[model samples]
Target: MTDAERIARVQLARTKGVGPLTYSRFLETYGSGLAALEAFPERVRASGRGELKLYPADKVRREFDETDHIGARIILSGDEDYPELLGHLSPAPPVITVWGNTDLLKKPCVALVGARNASAAAMRIAHDMAHDLGNGGYTVVSGLARGVDTASHNGSLSTGTVAVIAGGIDNIYPAQNEKLRDQIKDTGLVVSESPFGHEPRANDFPRRNRLITGLSLGVVVIEAAQRSGSLISARTALEQGREVMAVPGSPLDNRTRGSNGLIRSGAILVENAEQVIEAIAPAAPSQASLFEMPDDDLDDETLEFSEEDRARIIQALSPTATTIADISLATGIPSRKCAILLVELELEGIAGSLPGGLVRRQN
Candidate 1:
């Protein structure tokens, strides 16, 4: 892509109401970011929403300059170097900033995550598993957090590792891991979907966890409490159709509860790297060909509706999450039209889209 096209992609992504799904739909509808930007106002009006704010060109330009100055590069979804596995996500990130060896992303990867205050035994198991996985030709992927995450990276640093940070590529959280972050930058890879210099907020971690699992062939949970972020990652992995593995911890330990529950729910029970390898081996061939086929072309024709029609669709929605199929049945709208309307509702802040393609009215 040309520099102007690249900048426009970044601008659209930074725009207030344009999320990943919307950005993708815009691309499909307009065929280019510049065209999408030009057409957005009309689209907003058609949604029965007033004028929407377009992201400032100056801000996007400055972001590009800053990324260049910091020696990091932005990888768009269509970029050749973007991870193939991650691109399969329904609402995959439109852009990600990468520092260090982007080539590592091509190798098969397995995510290892667990408790922040991991037990010594759990940490040892994590480190050894990481090392064994690395030797087996899989690049270990993880968030650069404490305990298990840190140990996983340390074990695989010399071989291959990828740290998906919640903050900017330049903003290292857990300040104590500054040295480790630097090591990964120098030797492995550091990735983030946030803008340059942006510090991580409390809510960013779950988003980060998604990328951790999104980029991997599978996820392995070592020791995770019921409410822990590691469980969240495992859940995301399952949602993405990736394998989920867990190490069985002592029944006495609280951290083991979540992982045990996962195994009971059909996650593979794994002990060492060998089991993980075995569990993921069948998936490896398919993942290698994941992006080989073209995605189904989204319908390019824009659906137009009368103001009354729009209101009727809105009235049919409730705060309670409803499936688009049900909405189509209720409103007597075609499924495709229902989808377009839901996207418009999301863009207009009239509705929210949940995982599993459910939608609900926004309060």
Candidate 2:
């Protein structure tokens, strides 16, 4: 990829309505960032999404400038240095900004996430788990929050740790961890989807949680409320087919309630790092070369649909499943055209086909 392509990928990622899935779909349809950048205006026009606004190339070039100014670089998902585990995730970040040792991503990783306001014991558990995991040649992944998140990063600081911050690498929120954040950049790696200087917001936290699990082979939730961010990360791990492990905390402590609940819901109940390492040992050696992308054949230009066919299909699409007959009738398009369009959408990772002749957009 050229510098121009990198700038275009970043621009599309920063664009309105051009999410990871949409950007990827556009790339597939256009075959290159240059082509995608050129085709986007008309693509949105046909889809009736006039509000779609891609970040101007000049502005995104400035973003690259800012990244370089901060001693960071953008890692495209298709790039060799991009985390392979994360690259395979559904609608993964199109591009991630990074600081420090990207080499640490090669080691096996385990995520430790928990309540931001966890108890003393929870902090200790995170610390111990991270320390031992680091000693076992594993990189500990976490958000650098106040309680357990902070403890996890702190403990693994000496060995190896990857801080997947909710905000940009330069904009350290929860200001108290600013120093620790600096230490992480020096020792390990810091990553974020947001451009540099962008502050962390509540909305961005969920996306950040997914990256925590995306980087790890397993996620360990120490202390979380029944519906906390930690559980969200753990759930993402389950979604990504990564192992879900949680420490059994006391039911009485509200902070531990979510992890305990997860334990009951079939997550691995682990007390020490030995359990974590032993559980992962069998698969680790075999999958050591995981950073390599599996599909060398996947290239753009695979998405080709006539405007009439695309319109007919979109008109038929709804939140609920629709049969062939229903789709044909609703779109006023032929059966063959509808089927072909749906296949194209599915291949582009835009939609999923369900059983009994149904289709719906994937989240």
* Cα-based TM-score, every candidate: 0.88, 0.84
Tell me how far candidate 2 lies from the true structure as C-alpha RMSD in angstroms. Answer: 5.6
Spell out the clash pairs found in candidate 1: none
Residue-level error in angstroms, candidate 1, position 56: 1.8
Against the true structure, whose lDDT is highest?
1
**Winning model by TM-score:** 1
Model 1 misplaced regions, further than 4 Å: 45-52, 284-303, 315-340, 355-363
- lDDT tens readout by residue for model 2, 92-155: 6788989989888889899998988888888898999999999989999999889998999999
Model 1, residue 4: C-alpha shift (Å): 1.7
Report the poorest 10 consecutive residues by lDDT, candidate 1. 288-297
Off by over 4 Å in 2: 282-308, 315-363
